[model samples]
Target: MNAIHNTYWLLAAAAALILIGIGSSLLARRFGAPLLLVFLVVGMLAGIDGPGGIRFDDVAGAYRIGSFALAVILFDGGLRTRRESFRGVFAPTLLLATVGVVVTAALTGLAAQWLLGLGLVQALLLGSVVASTDAAAVFFLLRAGGLQLRSRVGATLEIESSANDPVAVLLTTLLAEFLAAPSGIEGSELLRELALQFGIGALGGALGGFAIAAALRTLPLSGGLAALFLGTAALFVFGATGSLHGSGFLAVYVAGVIVGNRNVPGFANLLSVFDAGTWLCQIVMFLVLGLLATPHTLGDALWPALGIAAFLMLVGRPLAVALCLVPFRYGKREIGFIAWVGLRGAVGIFLASIPMLMKLPNAELIFNVAFVVVLASLLVQGWTLGLAARLLDVALPHRDRAVRRVELDLPGSLEREMVGYAVAPGATILIGTALPGWARLVMVVRNGEIHMPDVAGSLSSGDYAYLLAPPGRVYRLDWLFAPPDEAIEAEREMFGEFSFDADVRLADVADFYALPIRAKDAPLTLAEHFARRYEHTIEVGDRVRLGPVSLIARELDDDGVRKVGLKLERLGNVLVRRPWLARLLPQRFVAR
Candidate 1:
């Protein structure tokens, strides 16, 4: 009977947790506080002191669950990273993760010692634990909330947050062990341990990621299944490295970069799953931590906690960022922005639990300090991150004139066509051109004139215009207008070998492929007819052919079939090509 009751209770608890998670996620958007905070509050409500009255005082279980959840979350985060973003930011990010963490920890430790009268060990623990920024926190807040910034600035923060946590966790664990040992390890030994952790973690991560990428390229995994298998492999790497006394976090993060950069099959769908899983892990981890807290214990340490929190926020974080960024030539505003946005959440709380579990002297005090710090970070730094970005003048301006790709069929074409090109400023060819061929503008909407080009006409960044061109020559256009290196690659679509600056005219385009079929004054599908005359297979799934361009297939939806939308290019057939070295090496890899 007792066992039966236990089973029923467990089932009920699971059901309640599900309902709470769904409700909290929905409420999170309405409330300015992050969704994880809501989950924490909800978990607290379900605890002994709240309506649920469930006594969940299982610290060991909590720790086990938290560790597993965090490992998976970190691994997933790594697998979805873009390796190129790390190029310029790597040196600075590394310094921030290493020297910056040490400096911040030391500064905060001193402050804690002076302000709160904490012992040296306790102060160091507090500092080290809170030193690293929370990956889950920043990732969710900045990206999911649509917080935008300049490419470099956004890249720096994202990379730093993702890169630094493993080091902090290492510090926390090592420090905790040292403090508890009857004969504490020597400082030299501690340094050695730190070096080993980083060495193994970084090397393992790089090797693991490369191995996974190589395997995926050579392996025969299907798209959907490949995504799942890749995620699992990342987790395996993290666990395997950590179990060998190495930094698994580093391994996982590095692995993610490798996978993220490569053209893996079904990566988009996998990214979706990884992001969703990360949120779930964060909610559960934070909520469990919140529920485990006793209000009475927290209340006792409140004043000191507040003091420590204030010191970490106002003094420790800013100083660290400023010092680390100086060598990178970051401007004042960029430095200031990074400084202000060092929001802490679950990581600190989880670290505090380490001391509590070990029954360290003043464990409750540490927990209270951690809790206060977490609250302050969320309320102060997290909320102000966006405003700070704007104030610093580092926010990237949003431009709506960027090119958009759309597929249009001419009046009576049995086949399809692909078009791609960019509108250049002061384009001579557009000045004396005709309606379908001369207009050059693909976005002007009146009279089916997409857009008009002028001497001062602003070219939309990353635009791929859809026009009817020959199938074999579209690649020439893509080669022409590929953005200056480092621009985000736009999604690919089908057009006759879509590229930039080809001589395919708009009317010629419609006439060639039979586009603009919906309107009364539609042009002829000459491109489509050309495809039929050549005995080429120009089906729905096939690529469109301009004289030299080709567009690939993307989707078929309710509105219409969507292919790679490219525009007719106006330049004569001069294929702008690069040298072999330029093609082989990324911009960042070149020696100074």
Candidate 2:
């Protein structure tokens, strides 16, 4: 009966917590705040102090839950990473993960011992746990916020976040064991464990990802049941690898990336489902960490926590980013931006829970400090990211107009069947007003329209013309668009007859368009009129056409005209929305 009651109470607690999470997420937008912090606050409310007096002081349970949540989060993150993104950022990211983490841990531990008057081992425990930035939290928040960096600064952060977990975890565990046993963890043993964990983790992730991809292709299930299989397989890879003394997080992440990128049988819808799942994981993870805290203990750790946060943000992260990024030719702004954006969240809290689980001394202090650090990061770093970007002049100025490119969701299967070609300088149809041969212009893509061009419709030099040639002949659609250098001499044979230089002619009214003259231009065109017919160029009913585009001339005097150009109504360029920026983010992983 007691067990039954406990189960009911636990279910009720979970239900209430979910509602709180939902409410917090909804309210977060209004506050211009991060939802993770909100989730933690909500969890705190449910603790011993707030409305629901559910006392959850179970450190071991918290650690277990936190660990599992982290695994899920990391796996999801890994699955989404594109292999291509790793090429540029990998070296620096690796350095940040290994060298940077070690340096940070050592420095932070020293600081903690000096400032907080803690023993070396306890300080090391705290330092080791908090040393690495929380990749899951940082990556998720950055991506969700739709923040765009000029280059792979964001990717480096993400890679560091995902990769640093194992290092921090390794450090914390080793230190904990050393404290527990008089016989310290030998250097050789430490080295061996590190080697094994990384080696196995990487290998496991690769193998597991390959396996999952294969299963996704071969397996068949309807009603979106396949997503469950994918999810289960991912979690299995994570758990199985970890159980085998491998980095399960690594395995799950690698597997997810592989499967996410592959042309699976049917995962378009599954991606959305998994995204939601990841969000759920984050919310639950943060909230659980918050619930495990006691407001009473936090007060004592507050000062130390603030100290650590300041040192890490001001000194450690910046130094690490500088050391790692300098060799990569990253500029001051890039390094500065990377340093500012190292927002910590779940991983630190999760690491804190580990010490608590082991019943290590000052566990509560660690938890409080970790929470404070997360809060500081979200408030200080998260909010100021855009401002920092601007101050650093890292952002490019907005253009007056932009063109939207056609995004082809071409089937991979059909890739082998199609041949893509760019309208080259020497192409018979594109050169000097000559139209493309019907054979070459099998399909012309212009302004989002794909159609067979009429013989009279000339192929402009910039057009992308598709040929109906067999696809297996080329490796990629891009290959079809290769420059003349890659083309056969026979391909160039068609260009010899075309004129290389032709004086392009515009219509007679190229510069002279018949429109209601503006007051400023009125002096130029209708000044001889006996009476002033209208406000001139400054009048409301003025319009002009430039090529296929139209322009609206606002009524303005000479000085005004000098300052402001004609207001273009629908500029010649198509207003391309930012490539579904967030949607493109998911695709980046596949590229890797």
Candidate 3:
């Protein structure tokens, strides 16, 4: 009876903690507090050091929970990552994940040696523990804060965060092993292990992802069952890879990328379920780590930990980033933003547990110091992320509000999905904006009445319209249903006053705007000029300056750029160059 009562009490307490963490997310967002920090604080408050006074010291259990949670978080991150994002960033991202991690660890290890008075191996281990940027922290803060960063910058950060964990884990484990028995390991064996970890992890992930995606497509699973199957299959891959002595974190993340990019059944269901699952995992992981920490013992190490954290944020991360990115010709602003966003979170704490698991000398000191560093990071770096992005000009200048979109898998086809959208008052669709040829409206619900596309005639405000579109292409239809007042205004300001077909010749634009162009290049179309300027894929919002005018890619398709918008760099300069155009053109065009 006592055991049963104790079990019940434990369950209730656990439930209460999770609920508090979930509820605290709202408050965190309101106050611009990092959600992970809030969760950690909640767990701390419930610990022996704080008011709740719950005595918990389960290091192994916390490590286990954290491993599982991080796996899920990485898998989800991979799933959400688009293949297109890797277009031009693959090389630089890889370097950042591998070479960059090493440099950061080296620099930070030096700081730890000086401040904490730790030996060489121990200092490096400490540095390795906190080396990788946490995927959960990066993903959560970016999404929750509603930041839409530039494509290159965002992709590099996301992919780097997901990919670098394996390196950090390997380094931490290797150092821990060396600390445990310095005589047993050889240099050649270390190299072999590194090769095996990455090679096998990548190969296993690709194979496993393909297998899961095939199963999802071939099996008759649906709804919740399909989502369940996906989660379990991913875990199986993770465990299998780890059992084979490969990096399970890398394997699982890669598998997610493959599976997510493939057209599998119940994709929408999988996304919805995994989104919730990752959130739960993050909260649970942070809470467990928090409970494992002995806050009272941290006072001795607080100042040194703070110094290390400051050095990491100011010197270590920035120096490493600049070295890795300068060869790639990344702009100063892009490098600065990426360096600042190298936030340490759950991964560091989780890695610190390894030393505890190994029973290393000064393991407690490492754990406490790591805890302080993570706390300081989340408090300072997380809070200022949005502000830094804005000041650094890495964030794209556009409203990133949520669109009311619902996606349902088509019964017989993987190529198409049934997507529904709520028509806003000033939607472009209401003004007869045509959707892409690939999209076809099939149904409309207006004021509680269901009508076929033909019966509905035209979509009106307050109508719910459903269209059949390729699974991943539904986002292209968003602008048609979006309330365009703000979006249109913003686009006009950013792009230009007017748009012209990309096929328009540079000579014609130069003649009209009274701008000089090289005679050899004058015959080239705007699209051709953009193609020449950018060796990689040219996305919308890409701009090219032409004397006092700027040409922006307004619209693009598979064929190439479809439309180009032109903006005068300085209205006064343009007027001075072509004085008569002030009287000939409307005030809108002349005033820029």
Best by TM-score: 3
Q: Pairing residues by index, what is the TM-score of model 2? A: 0.69
TM-score-sorted candidate list, best first: 3, 2, 1
Candidate 2: clashing residue pairs, number: 19
Model 1 regions more than 4 Å off: 1-5, 222-224, 398-592
| Cα deviation of 381, candidate 1, in Å | 1.8
Which wins on lDDT, candidate 1 or candidate 3? Answer: 3
lDDT of each: 0.64, 0.65, 0.86
Please provide, for model 3 over 1-592, each residue's C-alpha lDDT reduced to its tens digit, 9 standing for 90 to 100. Answer: 9999999999999999999988987877888998889999998888988888999888888888998899889989988887777888999999999999999999999999999999999999999999888888999999978888877899999999999999999999999999999999999999899998999899889999999989999999877788778888889988999999999999999999888888876686778877888888999999988888886887667899999999999999999999998898788878999999999999999999999998999999999999998999999999999999888766755634336788785433646779899998988888878888999999999999999988999888899999998754566577678777754655566677667788778888788777778898888998898776653346677677778878887777786677888766776556566666656763333222
Task: Write down the TM-score of every candidate.
Answer: 0.68, 0.69, 0.82
Better of 1 and 2 by TM-score: 2
Over 21-137, each residue of candidate 1 has an lDDT whose tens digit, in order, gives: 678778767766666666666776777767766777777777776776676667676654555457678899888878888888899888778777888888898888788887777
Q: State, as a TM-score between 0 and 1, how close model 1 is to the true structure.
A: 0.68
lDDT of 2 by residue, 1-592 (tens): 9999999988887878988788867877675677677788888888886776768887777777777778778877776666666877888889988888888888888888877888998888888878888876677766766655544665787778888888888888888887777396788998998888888988888888788878777877663577777777877887888888976766776777666566776455666677777787888888887787776777666887888989989998788779877897776767888788777887887788776777778877877787788778877887776678667644422221112222222222332233455565554433243222222345777666776867427666667766542322222223234343443232222221111111111121123322333344344322222112211212212223343333322222333221111222443322223324324332211121
Q: What are the clashing pairs of model 3?
A: none
Sorted by lDDT, highest first, which candidate order results?
A: 3, 2, 1
Per-prediction backbone clash count: 73, 19, 0
